[model samples]
Target: MMRSCLFFLVLLGCRTLAADDQPALRVMTFNIRYGTAPDGENHWLKRRELLADTIRQYQPDILGLQECLESQGEYLQEKLPEYAWHGLGRNRDGSSEMTAVFYRKDRFALLQLENFWLSETPDEPGSMGWDARITRMATRVRLYDRQTGRRFTLVNTHFDHVGEQAREQSVSVVVRKLSQCPPPSDEPVLLIGDFNAAAGQSAPYTAAISAGFQDAWVQAAERKGPSITFNGFKPVDPGADNRIDWILYRGNIEPLVCETVDRSENGRFPSDHFPIFALFRLP
Candidate 1:
């Protein structure tokens, strides 16, 4: 009887451990170039289906997209029924580019969604900051993972491509806004976007690191594909590292694998920039 009880106890513990160890969450960041851009052969209508196919193949649980115009966002929404998204155009009348966040409807529940500009007046919509060539914004979402019962925050942003100061200030603005969230700073947080600044070569990256966020690419035990995340609709050198898109995280998350997706269909590519994804587990 004593031996049977001991065996039962061990089995119960193992089951508990299995329950606690949830499957790794797939997170991706994509900068699908604005659909309206005049790219001759690389027009939006021409490659929309292929772009959608790439996303369908990966099936990320959470996705952050930059350079998404209103029409492009709507098209993606129609194509991907499994995901629920929140975003706003970066213009006062909502007619410009957007930084959007989309999450699997069945896997996560949306708790809160907020949009902010990267200016001194962050609360004001469509506000452009110092030295910025164009309006920039961020989409912040608080989510609840139904499978793991974990609450976390995700921030999707597009920093100004022309403004050096604006990019650095954008990081500071995001970090400050996060701090204002109701206590318990240790909650898992994910920041993903087209930063427009290469890692280790810009102030934005340095500021993020100073604020305690770890790059998922650096934290992953396994890495895959090329380091060049931007291709400009052309073939790129496999060894060159020119990544402007990134996934940074803090709190109780372990990055399992990081990959820069370098997939192209035939001679045509999906977008000007390649998508990056990381598989992470909440511990």
Candidate 2:
């Protein structure tokens, strides 16, 4: 009887270990578009429910959003109670558009959160860098996963849509800050955003690759959906190479799959840009 009990316990232990090793994190990056923009039939009020439903369908563990105004963030917080959101606006008043990070509240504990401007004066609020058309910023967070007993960092941002030089410089600033992040540098790191630059066609994309981060889309074992992420509230062009949004990661994480979600209803999109999704395993 003792021998049989020992064997059963070992089998149970192995099963638990296998479950823990599975691809357990779902990550998504979305450019929700500015909530207050004059988008007529596509205004935030018109499509907020659709956008909420899109997020509910995926149920991502880690969600990064660009062009998220404070009001929209609050709406999401209210809508998705399972996740906790954090972000600071690019404007000095802390009330404009933001690069927001949302994590599963039940699965992770927030360790630290920081925001820096994408400008010469990173510490200054609303500081415009280079020839950027408007102020831009990055939101960084360190989170502890309760189930895996792992810690990781996520940096979310929105690069200037008009300034090539600003985008390149912003990449440099982010890379430097990543290296300087506290709590040591060995933890896993993820960078996600609407970069406004397509892969292989922009200096910032090249710089991110050189900095040792692997694009999750490129690293995924399986892929789904369109090649481009931006839609401009129009039908998806299957042949377009306008993949400006991206999810990049480094360290011990493995991307199992990547996808661009192009779901819509009644000819209305959730947002102007399609949200990208990825499934990852942390060992």
TM-score of each: 0.91, 0.91
TM-score of 1: 0.91
**In candidate 2, what residue range of length 10 has the lowest lDDT sum?**
1-10
Off by over 4 Å in 1: 1-21
Q: What is the lDDT for 238 in model 1?
A: 98
> How much does candidate 2 score in TM-score?
0.91
* Residue range 166-253, candidate 2, lDDT tens digits: 9999998888777665445556799999999998758999999988889999889998899899998999878777789999998888
lDDT of each: 0.85, 0.86
Please list the Cα RMSD from the true structure of every candidate, rounded to 1 decimal place: 9.6, 9.1
- Could you give candidate 1's per-residue lDDT for residues 49-127 as a string of tens digits? 9999899999999999999988898899899999988778888777788888889987777776778889988888778
